[model samples]
Structures are given as C-alpha cells and as structure tokens.
Target: MPRTAPAVCSAVHKTDPDRPRRAADGLNLCRGCLKGMHRNLSDLPWLHAEVVTSMPTTRATGSAPVSGSRTPGLPVNLRAGELHSQMGHDLRTIAGWVAKDRGIHLPVDGRVGSVCAWLAKHVNWLAASQYAADVRGVLTELVGRAWAVIDPDRRPMEVGPCVELVDSTPCDGMLWASVLDVGDPRPSKIWCDGCELELTPEQWYRFGRRYEARRRMSA
Candidate 1:
C-alpha cells in the first residue's frame, strides 16, 4: 500500500510518487513541478544576458537607456517576498557582518523555494559559528547555490580561458588575468610582455613541454 501523503502536498505526490523530499519539513513535491517552479523563479535573465531587449526599443524612441528601471524582475509572489524578508532578518541576527559583506540577497520565487527554506532551517547553526571563515563559507555557499538555480545554463570553462585574480596589484599577477593556454605555466605576475622576459630559458622550455602535453590531452 502507498504511504499517505501530506495534505499540503498530496497533489504533488499524486503526480509523481517518487518526488524528492526537498526539506526537513517532510513535504514531498513532484520533481516536474519542482523543476517548473525553479524555472519560473530562478530565471533572472538580466544578470546573465549581455544584450538588453529594451536598448534598441528605447533607442527607437530617441531617448537614453532607461536608468530608473528596477533590476530586471524579482519573484512576484508574496510568499517569496516574505521568505526573503525572514531570511534577511535571521541572517542579520546570526551572521549580520557576513551577510552585509557578501550582500546576501535571497532569491526565491516558486513552489520549490527549497533553497530559501534550507537556509532558514540552518540559520541557527550559521549564527553560532565562531570562525569568520566558516560563517563566510555558509553565506557564500548559499549565494552560490542561489546563482546555480538562477543561471542553470552555464558553459563549461575551456582550457584556453582567462580567469580573474583574487586581488589587484599595480604589477598584479600578470595584470590580473590568468591567461590560460596549452601550457599551465605559473604566473610570473611581473609586468612583462613575453615568456622570454617573464621566465628563465629552462623554465620556458619545461613549461612549453607541459603545455603541449595539456593541449594533446585536452584534444
């Protein structure tokens, strides 16, 4: 015999008997419905999309880009807003400094508001942390998870790509962009134009060989 489903989510489990339980709340939700909810709430197009739809439309009107427009769109549901407010207040109490430093904004929208729900459940643990690193990690993890939901369409990082530096310096680590190529050479970080200037002859040759190997492997 099938186990009785919670009245709150009976319809949810009705659709899919095997829907994942998203929280400690014991409420089981249909996986398809959860994905649909995620799609509705987490699709913050403005952040990921470079080209704004309003740009050309506004240009046609002979006006400057709309400056006062609020950020793309927020989740319009009342429950989502309440959840965000609740999370904000709780975070401020336990991890106020970390939240402020990290700009902890809870992005919630649909039925699967599971991320927000999870954070709320763990607020007490996050607050009782003594180390700043642990607190920061929790906050960062929450934010990163939110982003993962918001922008699900991520391209894999390619071998030949530039990653930004953690800090900035006048002669910063190779002027801040880690120019990734075939050879995974260490950053000389000194102000220089070429490998000949940045590295010793032996270092350059050894690094070149490694780079070639990396290229072949990747290929």
Candidate 2:
C-alpha cells in the first residue's frame, strides 16, 4: 500500500498553508508544534510571576516618596492584573480537564506553580491527545501574553514597505513582522507604521506578490 501523506498540523499557529507538514506519531500537532506547546506550558508559571513583578506598584513594594504634592502615581496596571489572573485560570482549567480524565488529583491549594508542574509532566501525553490543538493554542496564547508584558520591545523583522493600496496608491508605511524566539509558536504579525495596516498570515503571500510586482513595475 502506498504511504499516506502526513496529516497537516491543526495548531492555530500553523496558518501558512504552503508550509510542508511533518509526521508527528499520528498526533494532531506536528513535532515542532508539540515541542513549542510543551515549552510554553513549562514557562507559563515563570511568565506569570514575571508579569506580576513587571507591575510598577509590585516592583516598588513601598509607599512612594513624599513630593509634597497631592498627586497620583502611575495608575494601577489593570492589564497586567488581568494577564496574571487569566494565566492562573487557564493553567488550572486545562489541568482540571486532564486530572478529571486521568484520575489524577490537583493540588488543593491551587497554586499556579504546582499546576504548571503538573501540566509539564503530562504535556507529551496531552500533545498526543485529541485536544492537542486546543491545549497548544491556550498555552501559546498565555505565553505570548506574558511575553508582551515582560518584553514588549521584542525585536521585529523588517518586511519591506506596506503594499496596501489606498485609493489606488500604495501606502507609504514601513512594514515589520514579529520575530519569534526559540520555542515560540510561529509568528504571523505584519504591520505598517504609517498606515497602521496589519496583515494576517493568510494575506502575507498575496501581499508579498503584490509588493514585488509593484517594485518591478517601478524599476
């Protein structure tokens, strides 16, 4: 019998339809995606703590210096708080699902670190399960959100100028795409500063083709 082609990865980040798929032991996710998901789960707890420490009030750990003026310091970072809360919730929610199915008991205290540890131990199994894509998406999203708080200035790759048409003219915005770190899920962000145009992964190929055609026409 002829060998069947490997099934494409169903992970959310695998949006590049032209990319080749690799076999993954009959798992829903490819090996690279599975590894990235595992790494994200392992890093979630650390990222959660780092995001908390990134908050200005948390870092100060004391009352502000008296400046002899009635003024408010930086407003509390509600976004950071939300990220921290959501991280714990996501970790525990996934862990709870796994625990219920595997007959494993979660820690009574519901510590995020303990939950992360538990998830780390079972990530491989989780990657092979039917819910692999969902698990990967949740873990990757959590890690990405935490990274935004911890390192908002992550380096970007220049992707030439914006090729988006505005009233039959090309927008003059410079485009930059997010650079992915090792073990990061495939990055799909491509944005233009001048026009504030953002391209989804599905549009990247067509955008590139149009950009090259425009360039050749000018030359």
Candidate 3:
C-alpha cells in the first residue's frame, strides 16, 4: 500500500481564509515553513512583535471599484481577534502597572513596539516586587496571551482586563489626605481606611526610607 500525501499549504483554508492556524501564508508555503511559523509565533521576542496592516487596496491594486475590498492584513504573529481579548488587555495593563511601579515608564498603548523597547531597556535592572517577583514570568504570561490571541487552538489562562490595587478588606474610600512640599507638592493619596496598617512593620520602614530618599533627591 502507498501512503497518501497531506494537503498542500498553498492558500488559506476554507474555515477562515483570512486567518490560518495550521498553515503559513505565501504563494505556496511548504510543510517546514508552516511548522516554523507556528513555532516562532510563540517563541522568544514574540512579545516584542506587533501586528500591523498594509495600505488600502487602491494603493496596491490600482482599481477603484474594489475600494472597500482592501487587502486583508497578514499577521504572522498578530490578529484582530487576539488583540481584543482578556489575555491581550491583561498583559498590556500589567505592563503599564509594572512600568509605573518600577519607574520604567512605558506608555499605556496596546502596540508592542514601544512597550517592548521599554521592556528591553529596564528588564535587567527593574527591582522585583511582591506583585512581580519574576519579570520573566510576566513576560512569559504576556507572550502566552499574545499567542493565545493569534492561535485559537492553544488554551490560555483567564485574566482580568484591568488590574487594580485592592486592599485586604473592603475599600471604604480615603480616610484623609495630606500634601508635603518636597520641592514639588505630591499628594500622599491614601485610598482606604486601615490600608496603612496592612503593610508589615518592615515594609513601612522600607517605604519610609524610600520616601525620604526621594525627598532628599528632590532637595
């Protein structure tokens, strides 16, 4: 008996001619190309990649009747469906919080280029905290979410779209507020009652030292 060859990867499959999971895009991608693209979609630097679109069909096709028939975007690692999901926003919000918390400072944009640049620069020296002990862990999670969005078959973890700072007890709103002139007046914004007591004695001490250090830096 002779063996039957598998289907060729020439064009996008029928289920989704726009987005192909099991095949690679090209005039005719070989089995190797398909596999490589699949693997690289979730590989390292995947988090650093962005999904972008080409210009309108008129620019490329020289046809006016096909005005609405703009060329479909080809995303080797990005897709519309993936960027709009829980995983997509969760990773992005976490990046913002981590950057703000560590003073790395990446803009709160969903695009990967700028965020990845910031990640590249500060990931080495960014001090770990209770929220993000492992920087790589968060990066991995981010990549996982990106992969999940691009590839429907892969099951990704559930995530909150927005990450918030929560107190152990229910939030009752700010008890009081004060401002100090440390060269600049920045409010000591306390969000809840008893929130001050939630920190351990050591944590408070460390925080005090940091606050004083910043004050001195400003001075």
Candidate 4:
C-alpha cells in the first residue's frame, strides 16, 4: 500500500514532497529531508575532507576530528558571510606567509573574498591534491615574473602533425619537424620545404635517408 504523505504546516505548503521538508518553526525535519539537506550543505567539513587530509600536519589544531565530533561527516548550512570568514581565517593563517615571501601583498582584513575568487578562476576545485600541488608550484615559479617579458616565440617541446601517419624514420641529416599549430590527440601534418612537397610518413623517411646520403657523400 502507498504511504500517505505527512501533513505540512501552512507556511511550508509550497514545498515539494520529494524535497527535504522542515517544520515552519525550524524544529524537526523529516529524516529523508534532513539527510538530503545534510548532503547538500556546502559547509559540511566532510565535503572538504580530501582537502583537509592533504594539508600539512603542522597545521593541525588539537588533533580532534578536523570537521568536529558531533557531526563528523555531516554538512552544515553556513551563510555566505560565515563561509567567507572560515576561508579568510584559513588563507590568512596558511597562505599569507608564502604570499608575503613572494611580495604579493594579500589584504590583512581577514576577508578572503578577492583571494578566493582568484583561486577559483585558476585552480580546479575537484582536482586531486597532487594536481593542485603541481599547479601551486607553477604559480610559485611565476611569482614576480612579468607575463609580457616571457618569450612568446618559444614553442612547446611536443608538437603534433595535422594528418594521419602510417610509419616514420629518423636520419641524422633530416630534422623531424611538425606543423606549428597541430596538437596532441590529433594527427600531424608535415611538409618539407626543400622538396616543396607534403611528405607522408613513408616519404618523410625516404627524404631523411636521401639527405643523410647526400651529407655523407659531401663530407
């Protein structure tokens, strides 16, 4: 038999049955609703358990459960101001030193609004700790470095061709060059300026052999 829906007070009459229903007075909520609410709460310490775990041990305060004892993994519905306060406190205590050392003067007002927004833009929140660490390392290297001063002409070590390849070979005299624009997970398109020909993988290999032979004969 289908169970009858629970009676809701007039104030909460507009709420859907599936969503978490709470008493108008904020007293007791349905068990299912409470669970859903708990999961959805962004302030829950468990949501950040992975982050907390990767933090340096020296930052530990009192050794109790990092989130709290009463609701170890439970979520807490925190207001925007409260969330900002917590983040500000953490960044000031932990990241302030590094920022100062790098001559990036973070505000001392204990409100991390600007800092948090900056971090959100650069770092992927869902990435693993090791990935985040690598990103931090890169950022640290960029400290005090002017973006405009960095050489834009330099190319990446790994470049790909724009077309498919069947086979290839290397010779001492011929350079294995790829198109400047192609990227990985895509085929490479290579052409030889000397022959004014678009060289397939096999043809490129032959060109390399001929170039090497000519070089050896000249020597």
Candidate 5:
C-alpha cells in the first residue's frame, strides 16, 4: 500500500521551502529536515539535563518580612506610653512597699530599674533579725500577690517557722523554699540576719536530694 504524505503548514514550509516533502515519521518533520530535527531533539535531552543540574532544588519557605514591609494581622499603630504605663504601675507598687518597710522614702514612679538600684544603696541598715524578718515577710507577701495576678494555679507554699542563717559574719540567711506553681529553684536568701544556728551541711544535702526527687517525679 502506498502511504500518502501528511499536510504540511505554510509557516513550516516558508522557513525551509526548498526542503523536499517525505513521510512525517510521526515526528511532524519532513524527511529532508528530519535528520537536522532529530539532531536538535537528541541535543534536547542533554540540554534538559544541564538545565536541571543548574537549577536549585531547595528553596526557602516563608520568612519574616524585611523592615517596613506590610505585615498582615499585626497592629499598624502601637501606643508607646500605654505599654510603659502598665509596666510602670507594677514597679511603683513594689517600690512603695520597699520604701514604707525600710523607712526610706523613694519616689514610687512605677518603674523598677532605677528605684531598685536607689533603694539598694540608700536604704537604712537595721539589725540582722529585724532586717531579715522584715525583708522575708515583704518578699513573701509581694511575690505571692504578684504570682497570683498572672497565674491562675499559683498557691503559696507552707514556708518554715524557722529562718536558716547561712553566713554569720555579715548575717546572710538562706532558706530552702519553693513557690507552689511559679517553679523558681535556688532558695531565697535573707541577708544581715543576726542568727547563730545556720542549717547544717546535712540539712542542705537532704533538702537538695528531696527537691531533686520532687522535680523528677513531677517531670
């Protein structure tokens, strides 16, 4: 059976009108141009291989926007003073209590940084027993209240009726204590306390082991 040649488009012929017509060979190319066309097609595999090798495989996912770029779901305007005012109020409350207890009046400006530094330097020194007890009481009350404000589950632990003095020369007392839910480790220290009976080394060792055991059990 004689096979009829397929119809060729004028645009393809215009490019190579002198080329002779032949069977399509399923490649859509005339026989005359088929050799050149197959050569180009053969180069395509290598061309694709080079392109794939050059192209990067890994691309970064979504990243933080550069400065000044529009950010979705973020507040467009923030009031600087409003944020500071809230923080200042908390600090002023702490400062006010410290001033009243120590009998050293300081401006309760509601900012902790400067006021705490000033109080540390300027507060009047009292006898160790009076000072230690006063400081401990103040801290206990303030910390308990502060934690209660933020934490729904905060409960005050039953601290000892005894104050354990660690250093006597300068009267530094260390109490092995834990906050119920706040999870602050390392015992709180009350300084300048006039006391003779410091917790012995054995007591510290036992306390440390118990504390560790409780922590592991909780975990």
Candidate 6:
C-alpha cells in the first residue's frame, strides 16, 4: 500500500502555520475546527435568543397626536432585528440543505433552536462531507455576529497591576478592563481589586499610557 498525504484544514485561522494537518480520516476540517463548530452550534441557539430578547422596543408613552409625517415608527433596534433574522434564515437554509443531502428528516417547523440543535448533533458528520467549509464558515460568521450584537464587550482582560500611585507608592492592586456589560454605555471600565481604584471608559487609554510610562521609568 502507498502512503497518502494528509489533508490540510479547510478552515481559515489567524495563523496559517499553526493549522493542523491531521484532519479526521474522511474530513477536510481539523479536530479543533470541528470541536469549535460544535460548540458554536450549541451556543447559537442561546445567542440568537439573546439577540431577540435584547432588541430595543418602544411603547406609546401617552398616545400623543402624530400629525408631523404620518409615518409609522420602526423597531428601535434595527440592527438587532436584522441580526436575528439573519441568524434564523442562515441556520434554516443550511440545515435544510444538509437534511436534503443526507436524507435526514429535519425539524418540520424549522425553528432556529431546533435547527441549531440538529446542526450541533451532526456536526461531525457534516465535517466529513463536501460542505465542510461552507458549514464551518456559516457557523463562524453567525456566531461572531450573534456575539457582537449581544455581548460586544465580553473580552475582559487583566490590564496589568494597578499603576495608581498614592504619595509615591503604587496601589497594590490588579487592573482589569472590559467587564461584561451588555447594552451598557460604559463597557470599558478599568478597576483595581486591591486599592479600590476605578477608571472610566474615557480614562482607560490615559491610564494605559501612564502605566506604560511608569514601567519604562522603573525599567
């Protein structure tokens, strides 16, 4: 028997060299990509639900006379509405294609949650088929969009120790930023756990610059 070359992952990643060449025997995507796809598929239902729930709506405060333009008011959050629709449409379209191709019975109602559950269940099976890249791409895009709408500031990070100096003494606390605050006006809040110091979103950049300067001076 002759040895065959391994198939490269079809999924695009930030770093090409780090992509795994050891894809499953019959799949074009690596194990990592497939795992991520499954996880995202599972999360899609929740994310889509969040997007729907978080959509901003307006109610008649007092039923004032509307004679200015005679136009109907639209949904307050058009972006959220668009995202919600796209998520459902994409999930149903892909699921339908997969069902037809695999001869599997899809959910008759084609609800977003049902379609997502179906996709998550057969993610590996899809990975082995010719539509691996298409499925992965769609899943990734939908997941990213869903997150952007519901939790745009979810990437909390430790921004190094507290650099706030009090009488030539640095506060012995750690500074962190980007606390999860869905629909919050102030998402980028930097705070210290030890000294109880806090910085607003507007001051975060200045604080970072000052911290860097302090580091340079100490070095």
Give the whole-model CA lDDT for all candidates, comma-separated: 0.32, 0.67, 0.36, 0.32, 0.34, 0.68
Error of 5 at 209 (Å): 10
Q: What is the TM-score of each candidate against the true structure?
A: 0.23, 0.58, 0.28, 0.19, 0.26, 0.59
Worst 10 residues of 4 by lDDT: 143-152
lDDT of 3: 0.36
lDDT of 1 at 132: 25
What lDDT score goes with residue 209 in model 2?
83
Candidate 4 lDDT by residue in tens digits, 152-213: 22211222222221123111111224333445432343342111234555776776566556
What lDDT score goes with residue 103 in model 6?
Answer: 89
List ranges where model 4 is wrong by over 4 Å.
1-85, 118-219
Q: Encode model 6's per-residue lDDT on 175-197: one tens digit a residue.
A: 66756557755335666533446
User: Model 2, poorest ten-residue lDDT window?
Assistant: 57-66
RMSD of each: 17.9, 11.1, 24.1, 26.3, 40.5, 12.0
lDDT of 1: 0.32
Question: Highest TM-score among the candidates is held by which one?
Answer: 6
Order the candidates by TM-score, highest first — what do you get? Answer: 6, 2, 3, 5, 1, 4
In angstroms, what RMSD does candidate 1 have relative to the true structure?
Answer: 17.9
Clash statistics: count for each candidate: 2, 0, 0, 6, 2, 0
lDDT against true structure, model 6: 0.68
| Tens-digit per-residue lDDT, 1-219, candidate 5 | 633324331113322345433333332333323322222222222222322332232211243333464545433212222323433454455456657776777774423445444444432221121232243333333333333332233223333322332222221222323233245432332111122332334565666566466546655
How far residue 38's Cα lies from its native spot in candidate 5, in Å, is 90
Alpha carbon lDDT at 117, candidate 2? 79
Off by over 4 Å in 1: 1-83, 94-129, 154-219
